[model samples]
Target: MDCVDLTTVLAGITLRNPVVTCSGTYGFGEEYADYCPLEALGGITLKGITPLPRLGNSVPRLAETPAGLLNSVGLENPGLEDFLVSYLPKVRKMPTAVIANISGFSLEDYVQMARALQVDSGLAALEVNISCPNVKHGGMHFGTDPHSAEEVIAAVKAVTNLPTIAKLSPNVTDIVEMARAAQRGGADALSLINTLLGMRIDIEQQRPLLANTFGGLSGPAIRPVAVRMVWQVAEAVDLPIIGMGGITTWQDAVEFLLAGATAISIGTGNFVNPQAPLEIIQGIKGYCEKHGLTSVRNLVGLAHKG
Candidate 1:
């Protein structure tokens, strides 16, 4: 049986396929291996890690929406030391590309984390989570402003020669400015449409649904918005994009690629169906065959052509 080759590269890191698992969704690549073959995935972004271990958010860290899930997991992970000593060695043995996703409160924190990861030869790349708030700089600063984004990206780039992907946020007036800023700061690739900031009210209980009051919105509800953001940024920059948000099937994946995404990440859908990535891989093959496409790259950015 002929299948569409899902194999693709992101910022020079060769992934086995295009169906990557987003950070903070899959826990770690090891967890998925119990349910399905980890090698089938393009790559896995480990949950947001800090320089020090995090206990994460309080109770009710997760809430469910129509077709997605909201999580304020608070970047829970065992810090860089623990990850290097334990997780990294285990992940290195897996065939899938491994990425270390990092979050920091200040510029120095980001640089420190990058330097540590830089010394590790097993990691395929580093995903700088610049969307997180800068606790020392005052309220909601990083994602909303290009200056903050550049500062964070520049700091990390100075310490690591490894491929760096700047993960941007959707909670901004213009995503292009931020994308360009990250690129200027030396980001090898851009990943976008993180999550739309949202709030859920429980009318029956007369309170908020989540413990954090507001959380990032994901799943099918945000796919269209994600596509638009990816399209807008794709036109504004030359860096490859790792597009994600509400991807559940091959058709959705194709839509993102058509909208200008170089690769797609399966987030909410992975939780609903552990084998979602495999289904998407198969679906993409069928779509390519029916359309007489020799390579999936031919379908990228078809929606924006004038």
Candidate 2:
């Protein structure tokens, strides 16, 4: 315990630890402040923001599965200006590292937001969410197509001084190809396993459950898939990995770290228990101490040794 070090430096951003909260689930980093103090975790990814404020999809945007939550929130958020003027002030002062998540409809839309958030904004990194699956003609196009992924990432990296992390969608046919594409685009790091595209049926109504008809599926159900993708990407891509999908417990976090994730993010888990990050952090430390490891970073990609 005395010698263990939890510090994690990913994509040039320093974090006290490697347990971060996911965007959308964590809100603007203020909503969960009461339940999970910012100082207790590594960082918080602000909700996905677009160029213009969105009303989002119509009602019935959420559905529940046995072990997952499907949501069609449509990246609803205040426009970039509101986030900069109203949110960035407080976000810059948060106790832990802060990462901004951005989504857009077109290449230019992404470029517009990246130009605004730079080093002066006090952001540790920029998570380009090219994988958002809910909205019609959203950023998923950039996420699924390798060439487009490369182009969008390179475009964002060109304008923003913040380290760029391309959040990849799991809906792709070849995850490794996407990772390679992101690397070519100059992404400093990769956040893999964004929600899988899925939908549900309203048996009672005899129609699709959600008004949007489809949503991003996330939770414990996606953990295995996330880990598989992280392992696959880590094996081929040189970029550090921010593994996330359905990390709810300490063991789930450890699995991701072993699979090659430099850091792990909790999304729907936060909804179930806001204190999850704290518990998982402690659990990782205890695991490291018991194993006689001096740094948590040593856990990343350990499984690959075999």
Each candidate structure's count of clashing pairs: 0, 0
Q: Candidate 2, clashing residue pairs? A: none
Q: Give Cα-based local distance difference scores for all models.
A: 0.81, 0.94
Query: Residue-wise lDDT of candidate 1 within 160-222, one digit each (tens)?
Result: 978999999888888999999999899999887687777778899999888777777889999
Tell me each candidate's TM-score: 0.94, 0.99
Q: Clash number for model 1?
A: 0
TM-score of 2: 0.99
Best by TM-score: 2
Stretches off by above 4 angstroms in model 1 are 1-5, 133-140
Return the lDDT, model 1, position 206.
98
Lowest lDDT sum, 10 consecutive residues, model 1, at: 132-141
